[model samples]
Target chain A: MTTVEKIKPLVLIVDDNSTNIDLLVNTLKKDYRLGVAKNGQKALDYTEKHLPDLILLDIMMPGMNGYEVCGRLKTATRTKDIPVIFITAMTETAHKTRAFEAGALDYITKPFHTAEVKARVKTHLSLKKAREHEIYIASKIQKTLLLGQPPRDINGIQIAQLTIPSQKVDGDFYDFFKINNQCFDLVVGDVMGKGIPAALLGAAIKSHFLRVLNELIRLTDKKEFPDPEKIISSVHSSMIDQLEDIETFVTLCYARFDMAKYLLSFVDCGHMRTIHFHADSNRCSLLRGVNMPLGFPEQEPFKQTLVSFQPGDLFVFYSDGLTEAKNQDGVLYGEKRLVDFVQKNAIMESKELINIIRKDVVAFSQSDIFDDDLTCVLVGIEKKSTSQALSDKAKLEIKNDLTELARVRDFVRNFCEGIPGFPLDNNRINLIELAVTEVTANIIKHAYGEHTGERIQINALLLDDKIVLQFYDWGKAFDPKSVPLPVFDGSQSGGFGLHIISHTVDEVVYSRDKKGRNCASLEIKL
Target chain B: MKLSTEKIGEVTVVTVLTEVLDASNAEEFKTATAPILKESNKVVFEISQIKFMDSSGCGTLLSFLRQLKSSNGNLKLCRVQEPVRILFELVRIDRIIEIFDTKEEAIKSFKMGI
Candidate 1:
């Protein structure tokens, strides 16, 4: 149950004559909250400050007539829905018609029978309250859908997004989805206009995109992610009929970030060109868009552009609201300012950069209100730490399967070879490889119970004339000391694995963490 | 590791066709010859192609010898390369399996019925 209790509906009585106001006040004061506006301008100002459920008007005001006041109220979007009832002395049919034309909901003669006035006011107030409640619920649902939880980071890419709606429901939205463990997709879109219609279209387009993506994932090979161009085209095709029916178009940009290759492939559908800030060069470049906005032509060929990213590189995707935002002086905050801002702050974190850009735009516009919905998505590629770049350390993850034993050996050998001071003679490297293979085999056979998807993470470090290898697994706990040493009598085929692992390394230890993860550390003094 | 076999009078002669028999290729060599050892009691391995052998390589040979002997058969090594011969001496593998200088000598030992 809602905590706040319902108070009586407020009604504004606008009349030039005090006697008429008193008459209305005495009739309704006990039942409603009341406001008195002596002239047309005062009534407008009062309505602007506080929205009243109903307005009682007199047609014979001095400066601005009741018809003019009603006309102004009907024209403004915010107050147009508020019901206005004209109470006047004129009884002619022409006068009543004029009252209706001026946006009055009901009319009454000047005598103003108490019963008639009360009944009309009560009916109009109830109708207004019902409509407001309906809109409030609709806006709440739209808000939750528009701002659903989006991933902040996927793999090594950092994502930050900002959306400011011009109305209760924004037509602009951005989304983030992980295609796989190493690949993620970032999508930003803008519908043609604002408010309820545009918002519904935005939701429909988002749902369509998700449906098409799921279909593509199901149909394609497991190793292959959905193609960005094909996804856009499919979503566009499915939504074209509805979009045409609504007679609107949407601009969208979809980019897929591949963490392994450090590549970004994207399709821009007549959207604002995305900005790329190159960390190495400290320069910003706008990516080219090659296709028309969706829901336009039947078969617009969607071409995607591929860009390679380096560590510390930043990508900015935004709607036109930022570029078209104007100051009090009517100067547009153009693309140049955005480029300059990004280039200057390219070294900052992705979230910080997004926040600063949002603040800058607000300061430039000199107002909190935006005429158009504005949205921005910032993605940053992580930079390698200095120690990681200098040290001879490598981390590898492999499936818990025996066939991957060879791969584990290859990874360890490669890491040992990277040490400049120690070539790590073939014999020592061979022994290390054997120990790694044995450990991995044991994990696959014992710890994971021959499971395939479970992962074993091995971190190899060559530090201070020693080689240390640490392994972690979220499988069942394993006690190295509990495994009896195998007799070296040359006939034991199965138990030799653990014995060889223990003898090959200088020191071996195993323990389980509080979270039930198994950690094994092995060291070799070379 | 690659293998080729020739049969003469119920004795199987298998040759390893690689220069090095170290850790990387040792397991594969064992896998390739396990079926042959399981089938034949009298087997001869021509290892002249192997110039180097590591401890894993020696262990694999010992395992093969043990498996063969348990099945009432015997294994002989012929055309022993010098590096492999040194490895065999280091591991004292020469005392367990018969070693010969040529494939004919190994085949003669298997056929001598001693």
Candidate 2:
């Protein structure tokens, strides 16, 4: 038996004559699985229930003749592709033409040759098998290409992603890698098209990112870190050269965060905006104005923008799949909606933030079928230390010197910069400076008697979105709690200094430093 | 966007165009001309009397060439004025999208398409 026969093609034979059915059955049963129908109606019923690879029809069938049966079978989409061969007594060319027109693949005279029947059936069946096999392999490859590994935890950033392919595969991808002890990089991108071609291109681009990251790390370790702009520029050129198809381009965002410096630098290659939230101020901002997508050889040097982070601040990076996700009404879950969601849920913990956004996207789209891959990376800056609060009298000695005040301001700025969700706006900066001035001046006038020989030390620490500023000084002890709650008459100026500091900040506490000197500490949401 | 093109030969096609070439209208132009660029290597964009070319307009053209190059196809520009040329030059886009002198020369070079 040939390879085609080994697969056991099923053939349905319809003939009114018992002798003819037996003859055809005997001829085909050895090579194919056979189903016999005595009439055209029976043949149609059998074909509808069990779709066979081919059909052999006897032209002289009783009710519903072979020509009518063939025409009906040929008209139905499900049965049309099944090759039919006519076995009839009529040998006229016009009769053969009518058979062919009715979608018969071949015609055999009443005295049929077993070999001819076998050859034609074998040829058509094998061709069908090959076509099906090609489609199967193509779909399998597309599936394998899309089943990317989920992001593993790197540093404090929590990443969870879901990808749903609209067709056989998708081209969107997101990856996370720890570049060093103090830094981690997040990458999210989408290739231009869909299916196996775009999947392959996406895989290529992802592999390139890995290779470039490795090289970047090696260079940085060797004190030869190439400029990020140059690295991306070369990658753009190389990708353009390699994937020379206009239907395939990559819109990517590459971000590297240094925990030690509390700084994040990112290069946006014509992607959706990365939303950043200042937890302290309860406000949000977008990182916009990026260059064109990668693989455009003519693209200019792309620059990376740096943003400072304080504890409790959040950075959200996502693909267009999320923003462009459309609801059943065809309205997109646009950038504004995304930003609003992020702002409302920014206070949530990192894992909760991811879950909240994921749920929101599902609700907004109002469907389980996500048209594109949805991926989001949430980075939350955690507080580094917990320090003791100081008393009011100690704050006086700590504020005795100009050098000490400057040192305290520098420390406050640095601390604020490190925390996430803490606004480093000019208003907050000025408030910090003014609060320090008023508190120190009150400490000198009320506790230290303007003594130049005294020394004061103040420390400010970030706790989530709040900044705890502590003042310590070597002076007579004082308690701000006992100090009259300065009544705000709305027009009172001089006495409102302490009141201003209290209301300006989120909270204040009074306690003693380690040396028993009086200290006053205030906590402000930056 | 409307596409009115005059084929210089079997190789090159010169597009004489007018429409809002911004992001809002670029999709139509991109869809209409993308297939033509894929079939041939040489495409000369004649932008001498064009009115406006925003970032999105320029981006559409760049994306076209980028798509062409991905398929081992090439696209070139010709007959652009100093004003429009300055936009490309400003971004140093000349390095990416090649500019030619005339449509005839661009078509002639594709005698053996890439």
- Candidate 2, residue A461: the lDDT equals 63
> How far is B7's C-alpha from truth in model 1 (Å)?
17
Give the TM-score (0 to 1) of chain B in model 2. Answer: 0.79
- Over the stretch B9-108, how does candidate 1's per-residue lDDT look in tens digits? 8789999998766555678999999888877889999988886555567778878878888888888899997656754654567777789998898889
- The segments of candidate 1 whose C-alpha lies over 4 angstroms from its true place after superposition are A1-5, A27-31, A39-131, A192-200, A280-283, A320-347, A357-374, A385-526, B1-25, B28-34, B37-114
List TM-score per model, in order. 0.57, 0.41
* Per-residue alpha-carbon lDDT of candidate 2 for residues A392-462, written as tens digits (9 for 90 to 100): 11222244643354445555555554443334654566456546655665665567775777766666665
**lDDT per residue (tens digit) for residues A1-526 in model 1:** 0211278788999999999999999999999999999999999999978878789999999999999999998765457778999999999999999999999999989897998999999988778666555545545545665544556535456778877665334477677778665578888888886566777778777788789989998999977877899898889888888888888999889898877567899999888889999989999999977888888966657888999888788999998988888776668899999999999998988889999999999899876657667788888877654223565578899888666767887898777655443336656676777678767767777899956689999998877667789988989888767777654455643355566666668888888999988988889885
Off by over 4 Å in 2: A1-162, A217-227, A245-247, A383-526, B1-114
Candidate 2 - CAPRI tier? incorrect
Top candidate when judged by DockQ against the true structure: 1
Interface RMSD of 1: 5.3
